[model samples]
Target: MRLRLLVALMGVGAALLCAMPAASYAQSCEMKLGAMGPMSGGAAQWGLAMKSAAELAAAEVNAQGGVKIDGKQCKVVVVPYDSKYTADGAAAGSNALAAEDIHLIIGPVGSPEATGIKPVAARNGQLAWNAAYAKNSLEPKFPLMFHIAPGPAVWADAVIKRAEKEFPMKSVALIAPNDQGGTDIVSVDAEAYKANGIKTSEEYYQRGTTDFAPIVTRILASNPDVVDTASSPPGDAGVIIKQLRLAGFKGPIGRLGGPGTAEILRVAGGLDVVKNFYWFETVPTEDPKVQEIDSLYKKLLGKDPVGGTAVWADLPAARMTLKAVSLAGTDNAKAVAAELRKMPVDDPNIGKGYWTGKKQFGIAQELSFPFGIGIIKDGKNLGVERQPARPD
Candidate 1:
């Protein structure tokens, strides 16, 4: 029964994504925005998506004769770099961009990479609109570093609280990559799960791992009722699930951040094998306001919006940065970052509120964007459906 549901979800996710039209590009303009992410590594898809979205957004703004900052129409332009999923690479890319005389930075998609380049952003007096999740990564504080989403700690806590009520499993197992980002999130999950009186088992694997028989055997032996996977992109998660099924393990699995049903289905061959897997999905369903933004995105890019948690960050960060720059009446990153502290965002994803309270990096920079849960159900080889993630 569970397998059947997963197959159904796979189909749904694919249809929605494929339904999107190719992006129609708008006319180019002058204001340049530097964007960075892992463009040429195991996580390149993430960077590609970010690049595509940022470019599309910039084109849209540029088409309107650019953003009117202090009465001057500066056309939006985006410069992007591939961090190659490495901290060193990310830092180099950031410094290289800082030397280019640009004002704002968009990414460095993975958390570890984000940590590597954050200091560079601070030293050069630039704003880093982080697009990755690293629990406690932004703490002890660096100036000019702004996080748009809740960290992995928040996600771990959410999963624990939900699991306690929903699954009511006696023991849960966790599998995460040994990378800095994954380890950090696992730590968070362990702490939160233990605090909730949840028995836990854990195993760590290197990134780029495709075979999961050994891990699956270990997990089954541990006899965990629930498994939490802190992997991204959905592809790796798919591999893990398929191997689990092949190993004859029958337990629920949760994945973080992979809703592209096609990716999972293609790798798993069938949704039945992956029916028990779930992911923390962040995109909200069709809302009137989001639809309006989607229309605007389509109009400018000639493509439907590929909704993701990043869009919330990209759109609002762009807006905040632009507004601050306009209000400060200067292009200095320091001044603009300062002015951004006074700005308030009322987007549906970020919730209706202002960032007037605490500062992430000292008297400026606060969090935006809300985190939500999602589960995968009814999946096919190239299609999937994601319902809002509920407890358990």
Candidate 2:
């Protein structure tokens, strides 16, 4: 019955993934793995979605006779942990996973959590597949650490360039948090806007502030051509959009990231407010691959996938880690790290990524990915006015 149930679940997972199961095997090996991230807090969606990506990729590896390491086929066993999106929580989760002899871990989403978890990983000689924004996480700082996502530069360049060509912005106003995250967003957007001939102004708010009216009003008073919300969480972004739309500010709404913000749409009661919004959209949900993983994610939640869930790019990073382990033939942190760096820059998730970052982080262990400017039309990422360009 357990076998039957697993089979049924796999079917559902694959159905949602809309792709063949890449996780396979005859249950020959048990390779213990770890997945740590935010699973029950403000950033839970990223973690939960990451878990789905990790599990599905692991399942695919398992289905494929598992990773052939140490002269045997090892079945993947991913032990997931919630980092609570905090430094302390990340440290605790990493220690717990390490205690269980898990040397390979994926996650603790943002740079803050990734930074907290790295020390524990180094102590245990563990391998980490991380998604981060901070420069310090790159090589030398943590040779075993690999950044699996693009920085704000990637998104900023894509969105602003396209917006400049089509929408032609002269001045823009922003509502952003007053923290390091906000700082990161401001810096990236400032450079992008400057290059595109767009002057920028901002109104800052502290984290967890419920009222946006005063800030929004202040922003509108600036009479900018565009309203940009840099680094706003999905929920907060929704509120900002609704408040702006309701308060009668109608210029293109934008950010330096991807779209598929179903949760934001739901919060705003729909996408009617987002008539002209541009983001770093990489996946069109209509694609079979996106639909597949998206379906798997929704099933895992036992509800609909949240805003931007379908567009999560870290999924393939987990797959990349597993594949690297299989090739290395050992789970040794150093060995796996070397093996992962040797991986080619190609995948369905997040597009082609690289192992470059020496100039920024004193090491070349960054996994940069490809993305393009995409606009939300009728609640979908309807291609780009301009495709993203490769960096020099």
RMSD of each: 13.8, 7.3
lDDT of 2 at 69: 80
TM-score per candidate, chains pooled? 0.78, 0.82
Candidate 2 local Cα displacement, residue 51, angstroms: 1.0
Q: Model 1: per-residue lDDT, tens digit, 1-392?
A: 99999999999988976764322122322557777877664466566556655676576556545565555667677788888766887888888887787768777667778878888778877777665666534543566777554444445566555544434666678777777767766676677778777787778887777777788889888888877776544566667777877887777666643234445556776667776555554444334454366567677778765424345445666666666765776667888877876666555443453442143232325453444454444342211222232211
Q: For candidate 2, lDDT tens digit of each residue in 1-392?
A: 99999999999997976564434332656778888777764456667665766776676677667887887778888798988666677789888988888888878676567768888788888888666565465558577877666566656765677666656689988766665446666777777888877898877887666679998888778889988876665567778888988889878888773243666666666766677777664443444555577666555445444325433566767787888887889877788878887888677644555656766777666666555566665455465443432442
Best by TM-score: 2
Candidate 1: misplaced stretches above 4 Å? 1-29, 68-71, 163-166, 256-266, 286-288, 291-295, 304-309, 348-364, 377-392
Model 1 gets an lDDT of: 0.62
Q: What TM-score does structure 1 among the candidates reach? A: 0.78
